[model samples]
Target: MDGNATIGHGPDRHPAAWNPARTREEKEEQGRRKEERSPMPPVTIMELLEKCKEKTALCDAREAAHRIKNDGDLVLIDVREPGEFEENPVPGAVNIPRGFLEFKICETCPEDHAPILLHCRTGGRAVLAAKTLAEMGYRNVAAYQGTVDELLAALE
Candidate 1:
């Protein structure tokens, strides 16, 4: 039976709007539109990192480490995946995976204007994460250019 075939139900009870299935012509039109749609340009991690470097603040690992240690107000975030973060954690950094950083950032740092720093397994992910934060209207966003291990080494 068709989705629009609601037995013993009037239009008011089971309106056409409630039908989930598309008509054959509608499905064909949708297929045509899908075929005509242009593909999205490929975006590599390196390309995203370059765009982030152009738009966001670039902080050396040593400088970021120094500021994080010396300053009390800066919010440091580790944007690596959970497994990687659990394996080796940054002492003062909060764990927010890169995928969820934008969604969870407000909860972690309520003030958009607050000083925030980001890092990941390497500089690439940090750059992208920092870019996302900056796009979200965060005032002071810094991306450390190295992994957590490298940042720690620089801090030493």
Candidate 2:
């Protein structure tokens, strides 16, 4: 469909004030009302990171390596960019960037009970990813609470 196409009539059709006939003042007022009705309070990134850390399981790089060595079914995920994963790839980890984790996880490990470990450049992204996976119904999930370098060092 064309981005500029509009197909319908009545107030319902022009609902979000996309009618183009509405005054700028009316649009601004609508925006203000929307903001006022927001249910969630603003949260800083640091606060969110801490909350994720608390909600998710976290382990050190050495612990992650130990688990991978012992648990053959464990899925190790390097939650970094493609370039980063290419530059310093973990021996057995699959590259799944944090942004695409949700979309691609089912393909990689469909079993909710399968052990999964996530790591990134720093612990922050891994913690967030671990929290997300847990919310997505993954029963066994853990984040490496250290940098990729640290994880690599531990693997050795």
Candidate 3:
């Protein structure tokens, strides 16, 4: 036997395995299986923000305060530290730091779908808090991406 010769039968012995028709069908089947197993596409921040805008789900601290003053059911959540909240908050805002927001939001706002307006020193922590709330099944949540100084100035 030559060095390159087939070991057992012959080089073309597995004819069915190399058939183009079978290969195509196998590939299509694999693609179908993959499609079936693919997870739902993750929601993007822009989409979430857009939804917030559509539902009137987001507001700045001043807007939230005005709404609260005008018999709105919006819950103003300060996702910063207690010291920061004490330093300055939108009049009636509750101090629920970002770390404990997921656990405490339900207790503070019993309704699973209640509208929540969240704010921090800047927008970063508030966005994280809003995302956490959204993940926890809170349908109406928004982040105020402005600093305390900006909020105070706006209020004035």
Best by lDDT: 2
| True-structure lDDT of candidate 3 | 0.74
Off by over 4 Å in 2: 1-24
Q: After superposition, how far is residue 110 of candidate 1 from its true place, in Å?
A: 0.5
The backbone clash count of each candidate, in order, is 0, 0, 0
Q: In model 3, which residue pairs have backbone atoms overlapping below 3 Å?
A: none
User: In candidate 3, residue 121 scores what lDDT?
Assistant: 87
* Tens-place lDDT digits, model 3, residues 1-156: 444433236554553336678889999999999888989666787776555545434567677556556647878788999988887776768999888887788789988778787888877777777877777788878777668787777656
Which portions of model 3 miss their true places by more than 4 Å?
1-68
lDDT tens per residue, model 2, 92-115: 999999999999999999999999
TM-score of 1: 0.71
Question: How many Å off is the CA of 22 in candidate 2?
Answer: 9.6
List residue ranges in candidate 1 displaced over 4 A: 1-41
Question: lDDT by residue for model 1 over 38-132, one digit each (tens)?
Answer: 47656887786687799888888779889888989999999998999899888888999999998899999999889999888877888888888
lDDT of each: 0.84, 0.89, 0.74
